[model samples]
Target chain A: AQRVTQPEKLLSVFKGAPVELKCNYSYSGSPELFWYVQYSRQRLQLLLRHISRESIKGFTADLNKGETSFHLKKPFAQEEDSAMYYCALSGINTGFQKLVFGTGTRLLVSP
Target chain B: EAGVAQSPRYKIIEKRQSVAFWCNPISGHATLYWYQQILGQGPKLLIQFQNNGVVDDSQLPKDRFSAERLKGVDSTLKIQPAKLEDSAVYLCASSRTDGLENEQYFGPGTRLTVT
Candidate 1:
C-alpha cells in the first residue's frame, strides 16, 4: 500500500527563519507528490506539485526519489505562512487519481 | 471560475443518526472527490467520481457510508447510523478530467460532530 508520512505534527519557527516541512512516502512505483495548505478558516489549496517544479508563495518542494521524500521548504518563514500542511501522493493506484495524504504538519511562524 | 460549494457548514448529530452532505463542484469539472478530515489529522479520500461514474471507492465504508454524483455535477454523501468515530469534517473537491496537470479545488468543509 502507498502512504505519505509527515514526521512533524507541529513545527514552530520565528519569522525570517528558514522552514522545512518534512514529507516522506512509501511506494514501489513512481509517485506524483503534492503539498496542500489549509489556513485558518480557509479551504485547503494546492501549494505546489513535484511535477510543476515551480515555487508558489515563496515555497518550493523537491522530489528526491532516492530518499523517497518531497520536503517542502522556504528560506524565510513568514507569519502568514502559518497553516496546516499536508503531503499527498497520487498515481500509485492504477485507476483514478486517488490522493493519499499524510497526517499533516502544523506550521507556526512566530512574529 | 467559481470554486466548489458545500452546504450545511456544521452539523451536530447523535450516534446512530443519519446525515447527508451535498457538494457542487466547479462548472465544467469532470472529476469530483469526497474526503474525511478528522481533527488534528489530514483529509482522507473517501471516494472519487468521474462524470457521474464511480472511479474509486475502495476507502469508502460501504456499510455505513454512501455517495453519488449524478449528472456529473453535484454529489451527496450520506452516513447511516453514524458512529462517534465518524465525527469529522467532510470536504468536497473538484478538478478537470484533463489528466495529471489539473489540481483540485476544495470547498469549505462541513464539520460533523457525532455525540
Candidate 2:
C-alpha cells in the first residue's frame, strides 16, 4: 500500500522566516516525487520534482529515501508565497502506474 | 499553446440529479486525467486515459460515475444521481504519453456542489 502523508494541515510563519513543510511516503520500490502548489483563485501548478533537482519560487526539496521523506523547504518565506502545497508519489501498482497525493498543507506567511 | 480547458466553472445541483463536466486537453497531448479535490485536500485521480483508450479507472465509482473521451480530443465526466458527498472540484490534466516523465498540466477545476 503506497501512501503519502502530509502531517501538517496548516502552518504559519512570519515573513522572512525559514519555512519547512513535512512530507513522507510509504512505498517499497523506487518512487517519483513531486510538489504541486495552488494559490488563491489560481489553477494548481507544478512547483518542482525530485528528478529535476531544480528550485522553483525560492523553494527546494530533497528526497531522503532512507527516511522516506521529501520535505519542502525555503530559506526565507514571503507573504506572497502563502499557498496550499501537496506532495505526490508516482509508483506502479498491479501493473499500472498512478500518482498518489497527500492530504496537503496550507502555509500562511504573515507580514 | 493553450492549456487544459474545463467548464462550467461552477455547478450546483440537488442530490439524485445528474450532471456532467467537460474538459479539453492541450493540443497533441496523448494522456488525459480526471481528478477530484475535496476542500482542504489534494486532488485524487479518478481516471486516466491514453488517447481515447482507458488506461486506469480503478477508483471511479462506476455505479454513479461515468466518463468518455470519444475521439481523444475532448472528454466528459458524468454523475447520475449525485450524492451529497460527491461535492468537490473536478480537475482535468494532460501530459505527453512518451513515458519518460509525466509532468501534468492542470486546468481550472469545475466546482461541484451537491445539496
Candidate 3:
C-alpha cells in the first residue's frame, strides 16, 4: 500500500531560525514527491518538488531514497512562510496521475 | 489561464439529505479530479476523469456518491443519503494531460456541514 506520513501536526519557529518539516512515504516503485502550501484565504499551491531540485521562496526539499523521506527545509524561517504544508506522492500506475497526500503540518513562524 | 471554479462555497444539511456540488475546471484542461478533505487531514481523491472518461473511482463510495464530467468541461458530484462522516470540504482540481511535470490547480473548495 502507498502511504504518506507527516509526523508533526504543528511546528513553530522563531523568525530567522531554521525550519524543517518531515515527510515520509512508503511505495514500491519510483515515486515523485511534492510539497504544497496553503496560505490564509488562498488556494493550495505547489511549493516545491524533489525532481525540480530548485528552491521556492527560500525553501528546499531533498528526497532521500534510503530513508524514504522527502523533508522540506529552509535555512531561515520568515513570518510570511507560515502556512499549512502537505507532502504528496505521485506515480503512473494510478490513472489520471493521482496524488496521495499526507495528513499535513501547520508551520507557525513567530516574530 | 483562470483557476478551477466551484460553486456553493458552503452548505449545511441534515443527514440522509441529498446534496450536489459543481466544478468548472480551467479551460482546455484534459484531466479533472474531485477530492474530499476532512479537517486537519489531506485531501483524498474521490474520483478522477480524463476528458469526460472515468479514469479512477476506486476510492469513491458508489453506494451514496456519484460524479460526472459531461463534455469534459464541467463536472458535478452528488451524494444521496449523506452520512455524518460526509461533512468535509470538497475540492476540485484540474491539470493538462502532458504526462510528467503536469501541475494541478485547485479551487477554493465547498465546505459541507452535515447535521
Which candidate has the highest DockQ of all? 1
TM-score of each: 0.97, 0.96, 0.98
Using TM-score, rank the candidates from best to worst: 3, 1, 2
TM-score of 1: 0.97
The TM-score of the first chain in every model comes to 0.96, 0.94, 0.96
Cα lDDT tens digits for candidate 3, B1-115: 7899999999999999999999999999999999999998999999989899998899999999999999999999999989999999999999987255889899999999999
Kindly report which residue pairs in candidate 3 clash with one another: none
Tens digit of lDDT per residue, candidate 3, span A1-111?
A: 789999999999999999999999999888899999999999998898888999999999999999999999999999999999999998755533679999999999999
Candidate 1 positional error at B75, Å? 0.5
Instruction: Compose the digit string of candidate 1's lDDT tens values, residues A1-111.
Output: 889999999999999999999999998888999999999989999999999899999999999999999999999999999999999998744645778899999999999
Q: How do the candidates score on chain B by TM-score?
A: 0.97, 0.97, 0.97
lDDT of 2 by residue, B1-115 (tens): 9999999999999999999999999999988999999987888999999999999898999999999999998999999989999999999999887253767999999999999
Candidate order by DockQ, decreasing, is 1, 3, 2
